[model samples]
Target chain A: MDLFEYQGKQYFARFGIPISKGGVADTVDQAVAQAEESGYPVVVKAQVKVGGRGKAGGVKLANDADEVRTHAGNILGLDIKGHVVKRLWVEHASDIEREYYASFTLDRSAKKHLGMLSAEGGVEIEEVAVTNPDAIALIHIDPVDGLSLDTARSWVDRAGLDEPARAQTAELLVKLYTCYTEGDCDLAEINPLILTPDGRVHALDAKVTLDDNAAYRHPEWDEFAGSDVEDERETRAKERGLNYIGLDGSVGIIANGAGLAMSTLDVVNQCGGSAANFLDIGGGANADVMAAALEVINSDPAVRSILVNIFGGITRVDEVANGVLEALERVHISSPIVLRLDGTNAIAGREILADHLSDRLVAEPTMLDAARRAVALAGGQS
Target chain B: MSIFVDENTKVVVQGISPTSQGLYHGLRNRAYGTHVVAGTNPKRGGEEIEGIPIFATVAEAVEATGANASFISVPPKFAADAIIEAAAAGVPFVVCITEGIPAQDEALAYNRLVREFAGTRLLGPNCPGIISPGRCNIGITSGDIALPGGPVGIVSRSGTLTYQALHELSQQGVGQTTCVGIGGDPVPGTSFIDCLGAFEADPDTRAIMMIGEIGGSAEEEAAEFIATSVAKPVVSYVAGVTAPPGRKMGHAGAIISGSKGTAQAKMDALAAAGVTVALNPTEAGEAMVDIVRKLG
Candidate 1:
């Protein structure tokens, strides 16, 4: 899960890493108050989980209270990459002598922790990788060996960091590694790890992505739960424990696995119709889960037809069919459902669905047929 | 001639009991003629689950049953330790069917297996495990859908999609050599490259059907491997063509981050490697059918 910049900074601070003093605010008055408390020349950054906030004019410098109010009012509702700013992070602006980048993520192929450091910063690392790949010093650290001070110092030297700030940068890199490994973070990025005119180095921007699977180990992450700026449908789906992504198309999709769910959406498009949403019921296709999924999709006015494709292995097709039937009784679905059941006990599952065929309920012989029927019912003629 | 398992491979169940999913799938595996000889449960060491002897440790189970492979079905929290225990017991092959294991734990387990237990092969901490049809059934995948024989080797990142591919192949009267789910986790114990390499080396497996979803560089790397090493006809299908970026599509690893790990990117890479890339799973089945028929 992506955290807001403020939350990322706070997470950084927890690892004893130095960040610019900052405060988060929810209102214009609170922004001004935070700015005043942090001293003048504060950077009012829009607290959003997305990138390109600066290009979108979501980050503004305010020297006084009036300017702080003006910028807060402007940025609070400013949309960056479809993310509307609801909160503001006002931090004391730093005096930068130079900018650099540092991040630690999993080297999935190598099965190691990958540390990327570059003297060139304040821009996308991908850009630096394209222009001058040598500018970025990449290091692979085994989770067993971990990141050491000597290793980090050598890395800092390789990245050609400012000699004066190399010690502090290396120290900060060690702390960041701790936060990345021990803090249950998928990614801990400090873009533009800034060097001050005085020889101090610290993180200027924090882009942290926490591992959702590690949530079981870290209970403190509950504080970051309410920080997400999600749409209504996404929030509802999260509440219902369904893996769903809302889209603008007409055919609502529900499938058993991630790959099949995505394939269901692709097949809907292949059948000349777009999908209203992407929902994966996972391994559980019980009555309650199916009803919850149907109810969530039914709430969307854009969904004209629903397609549920389950190729049962651990999940039996008979159970899925019974679940669908039982779900129909629990929820009054306005959109017609096209189910394509295959795999274990599918003959019995098809037999169960045979008695319930109608305009509202239909069964298809295959996933492609189901998509074709759902797309046509959704008014996407094919 | 199967890659991972066959009639001679003895299986030991870790965290197995009457109520555990290990025993559940273990029983089913045994019913399918798999040598599910022993189970490990510290509490039920002297007990038995449907005639399968229970042992206190994987070492005892391995010693008693001569099991060369271990099937892990422990919960997420204990999964990493269970893997270590199985590997410590000197099991040559360890397949972890438990899902939702923390990436850190998975990483540490992989590291230990690499550093300390170098001889042991680990498949997944989150996967459907493997099946050599009419021979050995390891994990949660239903054995009925699998056709027992040769000509096709299948590997997938998704369990249901693997079942779909198997169903599609069986429906067309094409038998498979072995099917492996490499798992969709960011740090899978085994990879597409590993399975692809095994499949390429197997004599009975004539053609390969690879089912990949948008996520890591594993599939792209496998494409490169296929281009350089694999000599068989390869048909590929990657899911999430219409999926939006940055959203987890059910599988923990099935997310498109930024412009990377997209279905289009993976498909393009595989296509550039001279592998047949299908638009969807059904079409992929057709491509594989045509390829196999040409081989005949």
Candidate 2:
């Protein structure tokens, strides 16, 4: 649900937010062309979902077309935070008289929409929060009342903005809130919203996180389908229509519920085993989803062993057991499996699994026993 | 006595038609003292679902059956509306079993429901729902996890984990007052802190078992509450210790974003506040029981 920088800029533009005009370039030649089109003094930014790109040399200021080509070539295949710089956004550089930070996101504590404004905006918001929490003005707006001009003005003033800048800042806050709600963004941040020497404010950068569940309502995202930016394991899982995310651990988990899957991951680490990934096949503990989940976990080389935990209530335990057996038969896997099955038809389910799994399946009476066995089979740290 | 549901609770199903996945099993839920007053599906109105009357609207169902709660098994897209309808109809509790309700929709639904009906309690959108031992089990979670009458009050973000944790507790001869899956959406209809507050006040709950994950400030908030209000022995664990940054682990809400919401941070916070930290799910029961015994 996180949009790359280029996509964020595009979305911002659609919302009438002013972003320095930029063009996405795939190759060195395209970057050079884009820089030339923008007429020198351009910023070449890597279009990745990660931060710290500037420090990683994924961002470069190009004075001329040649510099743009060089920087773009170097950054194109560069990896920063596990995301390759496959594309760059070549934008006309702006002259900043001052930089300010502004973002709108959900504040769970306040249990309302929150807008943050900082006088020192060009740096990481984390630094701002830690170093000078007071420098950042945090305002919570009731969803029903919405953000008003007066409230926005007070927030701007609280951020220590000058009177003239306060008016613009207030206006900008209202616009940003509109963009957040209407655009369905979980996070809409414009770091370093610049005030040009001419006294005009513009969004220099746009970071957006659109709700993924809203994708069905936006058919326009169809063109964004098959985006090559995702990790290979994620891409493969996506193709198989299974919910999968890769992690950096040795124990792979396959659970039926989201909450349980996360708990499984936590337990694995608590037991001195790191989880390689989080996989939830939902309520369908049947053979198809389980098989798909196993295949996805098997694709990760970091996974040394697999854990299958099911608390079948509406879902039949026997069905999940059959699915596990089906997955083992369909996919060639070398890792060991530790399974805990309970609930309706659990005895029958365990019987079915016992018949098929024999020695390969490590079944335990309780969750703790199962986790211990799985960790031990995978060569526990202690 | 159980917390949320019991033999006298009248339950209504949002999707009661044969087309739904758990309609037949919902009938079995009736045997546990769930009245199953009515099933809602406009298309199947006036028909009988497992002999339970079907109604077109939640209002009609609630009025006719005096249903205090609802169990929704509708598809994801329509689930939020069904929840809103249930709230409008004045159902005291609504348990939505549908998964993948859009986060925005959930946010909207939760905000509206909590704002409009302060008395109403909602369990899940992509969850297995809530169960109150012998009182009534409206969710799809297994029955064995419930031990007729237990003193432990459980609040979890995951349905399966809730059952697993309780099953472990039940095996140790620990009973539960009630077990609730608050759901795993980024914006849950009910939160762990909210349920923890209720569990803290319930005399039947001698100990509290909380399962959380790496997202938002829910765990941190719970920690603050536990530090201030909760007098009972609290045994807790936070999942997603190894979840990668940026990627949401399984659950939409189960991601370790910055430094604050990590499992390590949550565990540290809980431990600092005198809550026993279960190193893993396997150890949750023993840790909780030991804490309870020590408190006693």
Candidate 3:
């Protein structure tokens, strides 16, 4: 659901928002050609789906095609936040007159479409909101209606945008909202809705996150899924349709439901343990989903201990136990497992688990006890 | 009396007919005690699924069956409009089970129904809906998780976690009054604070089990509300305690953007408000039961 910066810019360009002319290059030769196409004074940015790329040295500016080739070769295989740079976005450098931030997203509390505009751009909006809340103008739009030009203008003006830039910023803001709604974006932001020296407003940087649920409507999403960029564990998990997200920790957690998975991670942390990943088997912890989840977790080298926390209802606890047993037999698990099974058919689930009791599998009767056992085992303190 | 829904509630099904979701609803409703008044599908209007009459619109269905509440099983794109139609037709409560409604549409529906109409209450656009044990199982949540006679009040941000929490409570012989999944969407129709206030006012609810997640200030608001408004013993568990900042996990509300909505912050706020914070979901059940027994 997250778009790389280049793709975001491409999407913005469709709405008449000016972006530094850029094209994605796959190989070193292609990148050299792209740099030449864009001419000198181009920025070659590593196409990784994470932030702080600049700080990570993934973004480089080149004076000529020779420097472009050097930087492109260095960045192509470079890793940023565990994601390898396979492609680079080659863009013409920009001269900024002023920098500002504008974003549109749904605000849950107000239950309305909210737009955030700030004169302070090129920095995290959260910082602006915290350090100087007044520096940003927050506008709530009636979802049934839409963001209006008048409201958008007022918002830009309130954020202290100069009159000449205010009209252009307001015009760009409405276009961004239109793009957001039409593109099915959960978030469409221009961190620096830049103004050039020529009095022209352009999106210097585009960051768009399309709503995953809305993918059904946007059939073109399959092309932009970026399966190759995802981690091996996540890729495999996605193939099996299991909800798995990798984290940096030692304990691997498999819990029913997203909340419980997250809660399991919380419990592990509270007990002095950190979870390596979050795997939610959703409502039904059937054999296939459970097996897929376990396979995904077991694939992670960082995982030292596994925690299977199930509060069974529609998903039978006994079934989940059987699935765990099945997954263990199929996969070569290097870590110890702490099991917590409760709710409907919990007694049966425990009975099934008890039947196959081993040193590797420790069945805890309660969540607290399970968490403690899992944390200790992961930390090698058990 | 239970919170949100109880045994006395009459239920109507929206978008129920020959569809796959309708068939599932038919089988589930037959097992649960929800008074099946009418099912609505234009193509199959006047038809009966397991003896529940199908009507064309929410207005006709409510008028014909005298239904005050509706269970919406429509597709995601149309789900919001369905809730709006039900609300406009004077249905006080509409539980939308349609998953994956866009955050924008969900926001639009919630603003119009709950904020605009005083009589209307919306549960979810992507949730399992509400379930009242021994009375009526109106939503998609499993009935086996409920006890016929219990007093614990449950509210959660995730549907599966609600069931998970209920399973834990049922295992401990800690009966519950009603369990509500307010939906994990950024623009859920209901909120934990709203559910908590209802549970606090309910005489039958001996204790409260609140399940929260990182993201937004909902948990903090709940803690603030609990600090002064609620008298019942509240045992809480917040997800994403160890979640990395700004990462979007599976649940919509489990994103930890910064220092604002970490699980630790929510836990701290709840603890400061005198609510018992369960380190894990499993302990949440046992903790609530123990608190109620001690308070009693």
Candidate 4:
């Protein structure tokens, strides 16, 4: 749920955090029009989720309409860390007298919301944290009490931010905290909380990661959902309510749990077969869910054989076996399926599956043996 | 004695509505010898569910039944509040079985549990819970797979993986003192280190088995703790070695961001810390059996 630069800025603005006026552009003409609206001397920034956009030449200063068109044209299709730029954020360039850093994220160890304010900014914060840890003022915010204005001011002062910029920076930090909490963001970071010569402070860049679990509370997130570049198989699986990740291999894997599903993939590789996808049916191995999972995996032409690995805990293996049998009757699966059933009622489940064994359908006792059988059936040496 | 819950532990079930899964599991746990004392539901206060009294709040339930531990099975939205209520009620331990709670809410609940209710130990908001074999089962893990008063101690981040490891160990005639599923959330209530420390202190536990996945530095941190603090034989298994980066495998916390929280990193750290890093669950079980037998 990483936000594009423009979207991040928009999210920041929702909390009344001051951000430079910006518009998203998909074309050179649109970039030029955005430059006209925001006035000249704009920054044509590539909108990608990856870092180091400036290092990859995806960001450039455009002093005029011609410069905006040239820079936007160059950045629109630019690739930064494997993310191809499809959108440009045209923003009015800021005059910075000083740069500072501010970010809010959860510190898992501390079990608190961590707020970091540093006098040094615009460069990699990790380097700053390593070289001069004292330069960064790290504050652990109580989620119940949150960040108080006085505490924020003290944090700004402790970070050694300029005296004139302290009040505004603290104010903005409070707003950013609000944006982080109320906005349901996992992370809210401003890489250069810049101070102008006129003593005005504003956020130069915004990097936000939204919480996917909080989507039910915010209906407006549908716009962000629409922008996701998902694989066709992944999209179809999502529609079917199956957790599936498409990979580049021949053996389609399905398991009961997340850890087991991943282990299934690793064991498939260990037994001389690469997994075509990672699919976790979760706790529900009922008929409807299994049929949907089979249809999604069956739709993948790269899959030569399917591996159904079920280690039922709360999920009964006998019920899962019946679901698989029922799904087999419903879905027209092209690939062979090697089933491994274990845990609660696994013996009963395997006995039921023994009657359905064929060239296209098989069953194994252990996960390792099942993986080997699946690899062999997929034409790999096991 | 077991780490968290044993035969003497009195339990209160929170969020026990008619259709609540916690109510169903609570009854099952009570049937299995866990002291199921009371239940809590704001609307159904003063009512009795299967002969267990229902109170308006955790505090009332605790006061009425003298329950020291809480089993929360509420929906995600009310989970954090339920934990808070349990903690405020002077419950020493809370096992939250609700999943899909917003990370922020969990963060707040965790902080409050630590800062305000310092004596309270929260097990999970997304976990399967803890079990002490024949003693008492506090959470959702199947009680049949475990054997009481065994020599081995188990801790894990994944629910089914923990169950699988326990099943494997049980099949090999290895029993456990206690098994704790700390849950696989970014901000868990109890940590690997917390459970490790408990297992280290418990005299009944001889060897320990840890199951970790690719996500967070909890496993790595636990390895660091085990290297210096823990004197017991430790066998470990890390899942998601073949998982691709940047995608959350299954658990909310099981994601590989950049080069950190990789399965290789966790395994290497544990191996360097003198832990027997097993390739799979069965291998881990075998390693545990070997350690326990050597100890004997």
Q: Pick the candidate with the highest TM-score.
A: 1
Instruction: Write one digit per residue (lDDT tens) for candidate 1, span A182-270.
Output: 99888999998999888789899999999988898899999999568377887888899988889999999889987788899999999
RMSD of each: 1.4, 2.6, 2.8, 2.1
In terms of DockQ, which candidate is stronger, 2 or 4? 4
Model 2: interface root-mean-square deviation in Å: 2.1
Tens-digit lDDT track of model 2 for B187-266: 77777877888888888888899988777778888898899999988999777676666667777677666765687888
Q: Recovered native contacts in candidate 1, as a fraction?
A: 0.84
State the DockQ of every prediction.
Answer: 0.83, 0.60, 0.63, 0.70
Error of 3 at B19 (Å): 6.2
- Give per-residue CA lDDT, model 4, range B1-296, as digits (tens): 88999899999999897788878989989988999999999999999989889999888888878999999988888888999999999999999978788899888888888789999999987888999999999887778888776899999998888888888889888999999999988899999999999999999998899999998899999999999999999999999988899888878888887788999999999999999999888788888988888887
Report the TM-score of candidate 1, chain A only.
0.97
- Candidate 3: global Cα-lDDT? 0.82
For residues B120-169, could you state the per-residue lDDT of candidate 3 as single tens digits?
A: 88887667778777877777787877775668889988766788778777
For candidate 2, give the DockQ: 0.60
Question: What are the TM-scores, per candidate, against the unseen true structure?
Answer: 0.98, 0.93, 0.92, 0.95
Once fitted onto the true fold, the runs of candidate 4 whose alpha carbons sit more than 4 angstroms away are A77-82, A131-134
**What are the per-residue Cα lDDT tens digits for candidate 1 across B224-249?**
99999999989999998998888888
Candidate with more favorable, higher TM-score: 3 or 4: 4
**lDDT over C-alpha atoms for residue A26 of model 1:** 91
Which is superior by lDDT, 1 or 2?
1
Ranking by DockQ: 1, 4, 3, 2
